[model samples]
Target: MPKKDNFDEARLAEAIKIALAQKKPNIAKIAREFDVSRTTLSDRVKKAITPTTPTESRRNALTSYQERALVAWIHQMCNWNLPPTRQDRQVGKNWAYSFMARIPAHINLAPVKQKTKELRRI
Candidate 1:
């Protein structure tokens, strides 16, 4: 299964821009030109619609900004050749694992180490 969003958000944004630039915006014309939904463009122009996806979850212990800051601090620790295993003051072990999962760039090192050890054994 291919993992990618099907929605043409950039085109929709352009339609919204053109609609707003007009003195008397024509939602229907702009929608047709940009191949976007008339109702969606109109709603966006009027600021009547909210995002489909909620950015922050209610169950999260820390905010997104805080998580980013924590990641940056961890990266800095790594740059200084220091171990980055002491971040459980405000979060739990599960939170740490989930945080790693959420970040696509973070690689799980356990499996890699195991593979390396097995190769060394062979």
Candidate 2:
């Protein structure tokens, strides 16, 4: 397997800043040239440009309530009862959603729908 490239936040931030300072930010072109995904580039730009609110910081950074709710939401949407793993336990739910969100929507696994007949049989 090829070695994975380390994604340094600082480096990404600088690249995003340069792109933004240009007359017009061509996000797709920048992503193709840099060999980074558009979503990754967009995330870096959002982080570098958007000002964080106190409530957002407090809620997203320091709380588990939101994370748990997000986890529950994802589980429901995906129709999986799979429990969170050790890494999930370590980072909490907010990180989980953040990680999941990085995956392209087109690449998602097939949704697992509940079987009403199976439930009735049980």
Q: Whose lDDT is greatest here?
A: 1
TM-scores of the models, in the given order? 0.40, 0.35
Candidate 2 overall Cα lDDT vs. reference? 0.62
| Ten-residue stretch with the least lDDT total in model 1 | 108-117
Against the true structure, whose TM-score is highest?
1
Candidates in order have lDDT scores of: 0.71, 0.62
Kindly report which residue stretches of model 1 are placed more than 4 angstroms away from their true locations once superposed. 1-55, 87-90, 106-122
lDDT of 1 by residue, 41-79 (tens): 787888833447556886887788887787787766666
